[model samples]
Target: MTEAPAPATPAQGGEGLGDKGLSGKSLADHLREIEFDPRMIGMVAALAVIWLGFDGLSGGAFLTPRNLWNLLVQSASISVMACGMVLVIVTRNIDLSVGSMLGFVSMVVGLIQVRLLPELWGFEHPATWIVSLVAAVALGGVIGLLQGALIAWLAIPSFIVTLGGLLVWRGAAWWVTQGQTIAPMDSRFRPLGGGIEGAIGTSASWAIGWAICATIAVGSVVARRRRRRFGFSLRPLWADVAIAALGCGAVVATVMVANAYALPAGIARRLTEARGQVWPEGGLVIGHGLAVPVLLALAVGVAITFLATRLRFGRYVFAIGGNPEAAQLSGVNTRKVVMLVYGLMGALVGISACIATARLNAATNSAGALDELYVIAAAVIGGTSLAGGVGTIAGAMLGALVMQSLQSGMVLIGVDTPLQNIVVGLVLVIAVWLDGLYRKRLG
Candidate 1:
């Protein structure tokens, strides 16, 4: 028999190519070989630019510790929802009802705390707070389950289903409140939103920040050792160290600024009075500690990141998004995956409702109006592809930060509300366009 052509050796091929030609380089070879994603690097650079640009425009007011802390708090609600939203979009689906769901859940939980659970059951205690939270999650999940069932089992389009849900839930919320506001909720409930007394002490904040840094450093070392055990190629040890250092530095900076702002007005006055010193003339005085809402958002983001990057369900989500037919052929139950994704989305909506309501200290029918657009925009801006199968929880949260920063910076710099919307809409369009171009280049 005639002999087949000799295969190309590693020495004869390029850095990542192999004997079998271009197809021999797996997707992991192309992507995981890099120390970090270029997209992420670019996004970080953009954030820096925005920070500086706004700081300059606002005459140094934009980067104030107080402003940054407020920014983190304001962005927390959207960031929490964006974590779940990333999975939905990754699976090539969208939930238009998140904003409405937030409103509805807020009203339901508000009623439970303010009227229903208290007067009906004659139960008003710390336990009632737990009950209200349970009700919020349950209500959100049931709504999501209903919508998911219709879409996944009955083959209803997600857009159509969620679009209908959007209107239905908003109207339901209005009905629950009878077109009135529910306000002055429980004092214990106020901590969830991080009001004056709800924030942690400065010492606690710094301790948490350092603890995060330590955890990241340990995780990196453990991960690197595991990869070595498997004989997988690793970037230089210095690269890993550098990344860890940068992360720690960021944590330190954020915590310090928060500490600078942490000396609250009332607390500061107490300190000044005790020391018998008058407060500095026209000096900056800001709030103390990190907001509870920010901490909650961070927790959600970390949990979702672990799920999306380390779990089987997370992998299936990406598979479904990348190519549903192929994933199905490979034995993935796409319907179940889709349904679970939406259900998870519902739970996230509940968390967001709690935060939003706590922030406003009231439950109103319009509590979540137009928030859907903001959530989607945050995901898109964070580098989640609308084309599906590509996104990260961290990226989506970063996107939320960027969106909020822009809004806050513009407001500080005197941009009109109408103009702010116009600018944000433009940013969304540009982000999608950039994503398309990046994908095209990869292809």
Candidate 2:
């Protein structure tokens, strides 16, 4: 009898082998198949290139502690809102009203500090920062809940509702202030705009440097453990370690550079001599250092990351985003989830508004004028899919930074305001288009 034909080995495994042909592939080969998209890689690389170009043109000042700090602070509000926006977008929904909502909340916060608190409770300490923050955040949550109900319970399309809200809220903001601007914030609230930590001078920088390192280390460890526990695939340990190390190095380097700034050198020394009499003296130093916005962004990022990765709500969010019907079928409270997402978005916008108010030291009826565009653009640029079900807080933050950096750089380089606006609009369109293209490629 003819012997049974030799069983095919992996190399001769029919179609599977045909796919590989003469190419040898190890386990790493399988990993490569599921690697990050090329477009994503290219986008990130492009950002690096732009940053480098700007750095060169600005003679390294562009990347200075002061500038970097400013960039961070400027991006913070957007980044925070983007976190919630990602959740909303992941659910295959959009909220066009966030900018207006944010404006309204900022105005409310200012109004509370100026008129409401004093009127409502007969207390005029002039230090209503904490109270204003609480009221603003609450206002955001309430708005979110209402919108969520309209969308989830009433089945109203998010686009229409939020768009209407955009108009309504902005109108309300203007009405609240009677078209007057609110300014002259409390001294207690000033630091949120741009404050320092540490003993000022060199020690302050070291303190901040260590803080960043610690944060990165803790975050990396927590993330790695969570991914492992959840049975999610992860980058190699080496990769993780490298990222953490690199982040720490970057922070330290940035702080050192910021401390070298003329502003920091003099101010830090003064702050140091004062012996903790003041807040730390470093935030976003041009060419180096941290910015309040950056710190705020980092804080928001960490919070959202934990919420997304470490909580059941986050898992449901991803689930809903990926397949709402399936998620609902699986007994997930789809309505509650939707409401929660809107609420969270509202809260984020509110927080962002507070930051914006602090930054500007005023609540303009235009506090968040047309900000929805930038928020959406940043999220898309940072790899958040418009189709939903995929996004990262880190990506959103980075995207905002990229956008803000481009704007700031253009201004510094003397590109006219109109040209800057045109370029930014184009960038937003390109980013969204690229995201769509990337999704199609993935599909």
Local accuracy of candidate 2 as per-residue lDDT tens digits, 1-443: 01222334434435453343344544444335434335545566767877787888877868765666566667778888888888888888999998999888988888877677667665546457778777778899999989999999999999999999999999999998798899866555545555453113455567878987998899889988998898877777876787688789877776766555445555645644666554444643222244555566667888988998789999999999899999999999998999999998898887888888877888878889888878988888888887889888778877888898898888777889999999999988887786787557544
In angstroms, give how far residue 56 of model 1 lies from its true place. Answer: 1.0
Question: TM-score of predicted model 1?
Answer: 0.89
- Residue 66 in candidate 2, Cα distance off native in Å: 2.7
lDDT of 1 by residue, 130-212 (tens): 77777787888888888888888899999999999999999999999797889867777766776665577577888899899
Compute the lDDT for candidate 2.
0.77
The 0-to-1 C-alpha lDDT of every candidate, in the order given, reads 0.84, 0.77
TM-score list, all predictions: 0.89, 0.82
Colliding pairs, model 1: 262-288
Name model 2 segments beyond 4 Å from true: 1-43, 57-61, 117-127, 195-205, 215-237, 262-289, 436-443
Model 1 weakest 10-residue run by lDDT = 1-10
